[model samples]
Target: MLAIRTKNLGKEFWRQKKASGLLGSVRSLYQQDKERVVAVRSLDLEIAAGESVAFIGPNGAGKSTTIKMLTGILHPSYGEAQVLGLTPWQERQRLAFHIGTVFGQKSQLWYHLPPADSFFLLGRIYELDQRTFEQRQAELVERFELKEFFHVPVRKLSLGQRMRAELAAALLHAPQVLFLDEPTIGLDVVARQSMRNLIKEINSLGITVFLTSHDTGDIENLCRRVIMIDNGNLVIDQSINSLKRDHLAAKIIRVRLEHPVEGLPPIDGAQVLKHKGAGLKISLDTKKLSVDELYMRLRQLAPIADITIGDPPLEDIIANIYRHNQGGGEGHELEQEVAQI
Candidate 1:
């Protein structure tokens, strides 16, 4: 079943026109000139139940606007959308029971109260029974390791601890879908990894996960599929593997040799990026030379002590995609609006 779907969904905003000179400013005030800005334009998307998808884009690319529309926080200017079979704007109250949202920059928990208090309030809002709420609360508190600080005031807990409590509270009512916006932003390395693991666990339990993050690690580790937008237009929609393979069309090979290498052998698509006495870093274009063929040639160089071949960093791949789209004018139709997502 489709957990989320949209067809030609779009949003627009109007800004009052400003005049530079005194007379023009006075005329503008009297006339009230305004210009229409399209934040999202003709977006069509679908996400399946139990799927983990990353919705990514550059700043002001309408990622936040699209998510807001989906969550019923904002109504679209045109077109239609459904979240878990309910029109989000039409059935927002009902949909609230089945969906949870987490924004890294925003706090859903009360600053002065302990997380336990917030959890109970959420349970009441979701209409969960007393027994059920307590059982779920215990499970979340245990799973999130909140015993040490569960009763601590939210303002006093560390960012990592507070985020953990936040996730636990969001899951207290067992939502069917979760919308996560930069859930690991500002977290330490360990805290980020912990958050990613917890999100993966949530997805494994069959809740649809729609994630938006600037951190490439989140996209690489958490999402199977990626849907990217730019300037409010759909730019790319494909699986993560396909996105890397098709867009970048290259790989990085690190080889540690048994002996020092004076120079690399002639290979059509292979470029030696770095070479030390016994280590080599090579970038290979898969379109011109196959990985197996490159491996065979590398083996011919010397008896290899060790080798590791992997894709280029996801940041590079995403940058490449963005450059291609921008140079090709793929998403220039929608006026770039200043937005925070």
Candidate 2:
């Protein structure tokens, strides 16, 4: 069965034109002009059970809105969506029985309360049976390695620790569908890897995961399929194989010179993209230049310090995508573009 589905899903928000000052705020209550901004336009998507899918887009592109509607967190402005065979907004309680959610930026746990207390509260709210709840909770605690500070106040826990607890809380009921919104945001390398491993394990246990993340590493590592959105519209939806085939055209060559070169040596097969003291970054058309051919050409030139060749990471590719779509405006847009690395 399709674990999540949406048709013509959309969202619109009324943006008020208001000044920043307190006086302006007071005056704007009675004298405000607002416009309905389309946050997400007609978008259709389907994700099968047990599939790890990544939904990625620029800020205000409807990624969050789409997720909210699917999870029944927000009402859609138009069209319909169903998750786990239930209309998300209309049957949210029923849908909640089978779904999990984790938002990295928002903390659902109480500050002074220990995360264990928070988990206990959720168990009660979900009305999980005593045996089922305890077994699931124990499994989650061990899987997420939450014993370090399981009883400590949430405020005393570190960010990574809190994130693990939050993840465990969301999954305590052994939910079938997981919606993770930037779940690894602001996490360090080790923490991020931990989060990824947990997710992989969950999916291995037959949980279907729908994740919206700025981190392309998450997508590349965890997802087999990706759906890209822009301006609230679907831009690309395909297997990772297809995305790589369609978008990745050239490979990057990082070259460190023996000493600072005056100007990039003119090489027939590569174009220098940037120069940094002793390092020069180049892009080569992989179709036209074989590694052996380029190595031979480089060997004849000035001494080299280091050299490596690979594709520009997904972050660079997605940034270029937004640039192609929106004329290169940056902010939350750029933040999402670069967070993948």
Candidate 3:
């Protein structure tokens, strides 16, 4: 079953245009001008049940706008969408029962109340029966490891602890789909990993996860498919592995030598990014030169103490996509097609 589906979904906002100076501003009071800004344009998307998908884009690229539309926080200016077989805008109250949302910058938990109290409150809001709510609450509390601070006031809990509680509360009603937006924004490394594990477990249990995050770790570790948007248009929709295979033709090689060398030997398709005495960093184009060939050349230059080769980071690959499309050429053909719609 499809967990979410959309066709030509789009959103637009109008803002009052302000004049430059005081005189101009005063004149604009009588003659107000508004400009329409397209936030999301002709977005066609679909997600299968139990699939973990990453929806990522730069700031002001309509990522949040699209989420709001999916969750029924905002009605689309045009097009249609159905989440879990219900029209989000028309059947919002009904759809709320089957979906969960977590916005990192927003808080659904009561600020002054304990998480335990908030959990009960959310259960009531979701209209879960007392026995069922209690049973689910107990399961979530244990699964999320909230025994230590479940009773602590939300204001008193650590960011990580609160995030755990937040997620637990979202799942109180056993939602079929989870919408997470930057869920690990302010968390430390340990906290972030814990949250990631919990989310993975939830998805494993058959909940569809639709996520938007700037953290590459979240995308690389949690999602199998990636949907990249730029300038309010869908740019790429492909599996994570395919994205890497297509755009990641370059490798970074770092070698530590046994002794300092005056000059390094040059190898075809390899450019020295940094060189300082016993340490050298090179950018290798794997298409032109194989790792074995590069290793052979390095061995001829000097005795090697250690060497490590790795692909460019996912951040670099996504940034390249954005930059490539920003140039207004063949790379932006997809976006142009949406604009035409």
| Best-matching candidate per TM-score | 3
Clashes of each: 0, 0, 0
What tens-digit string does per-residue lDDT give for candidate 3 at 25-54? 897878776666778889999999999999
Q: Report the error of model 3 at residue 78, Å.
A: 2.4
Residue 91 lDDT in candidate 1:
93
Which portions of model 1 miss their true places by more than 4 Å? 16-33, 261-268, 292-305, 336-341
Between candidates 2 and 3, the lDDT winner: 3
Query: What is the C-alpha local distance difference test score of each model?
Result: 0.90, 0.84, 0.91
In model 2, which runs have C-alpha deviations exceeding 4 angstroms? 19-31, 255-269, 273-280, 287-296, 299-307, 328-341
Local accuracy of candidate 1 as per-residue lDDT tens digits, 26-52: 887557767778889999999999999
TM match of model 3 to true structure? 0.92
- Candidate 2, position 197, lDDT: 90
Between which residue pairs do clashes occur in model 2? none
Model 2 has a clash total of 0
Sorted by TM-score (best first), the order is: 3, 1, 2
